[model samples]
Target: MKSTSTLLAPEEEFPTALSELPVLEIHVLHSRVCRQLDHEYLTDPAGAHPVTLDRHHELVAELDDRDAA
Candidate 1:
């Protein structure tokens, strides 16, 4: 097997907030959370934890707010 990393290059500064990230990065994060929620639903449909859902909502709201501005 081989190993890979997603770490940024040393000269690349990581964004401190979602608002600071590029559009593609934001989409990737949203996609990741959606996938997580899907898995959580599969394992426990009735009582999935609220944290993931909250994050999803937050991302959506941020995008909406950005679009509105």
Candidate 2:
């Protein structure tokens, strides 16, 4: 799949890390991860990838930090 970042100019490249993403981007990613987890839960209730869960936790922490600020 083509990333939207490809359309950006050289000066407008997307950040490579979750911590570097803007709040809006973080929210979008967080929501996408949640949907993936929900799908996994429906398909295999006994298994959800630890990496994905870790990412969700990271995004949540970033959001929480932003809110506290």
Q: Rate the local accuracy (lDDT) of all candidates.
A: 0.62, 0.63
Q: Which candidate comes out best when scored by lDDT?
A: 2
> How well is each residue in 1-69 modelled by candidate 1, as lDDT tens digits?
111323222233323477877777777666666776777678885844577777678778778878899
TM-score of each: 0.66, 0.71
Stretches of candidate 2 off by over 4 Å are: 1-16
Model 2: per-residue lDDT, tens digit, 1-69? Answer: 124431222222324576676787777776666876776667776866676677668778889988998
CA RMSD of all predictions:
7.8, 7.6
State which candidate has the highest TM-score: 2
Least accurate stretch of 10 residues (summed lDDT) in model 1?
1-10
Find the number of clashing residue pairs for candidate 1.
Answer: 0
User: Candidate 2 versus the native: TM-score?
Assistant: 0.71
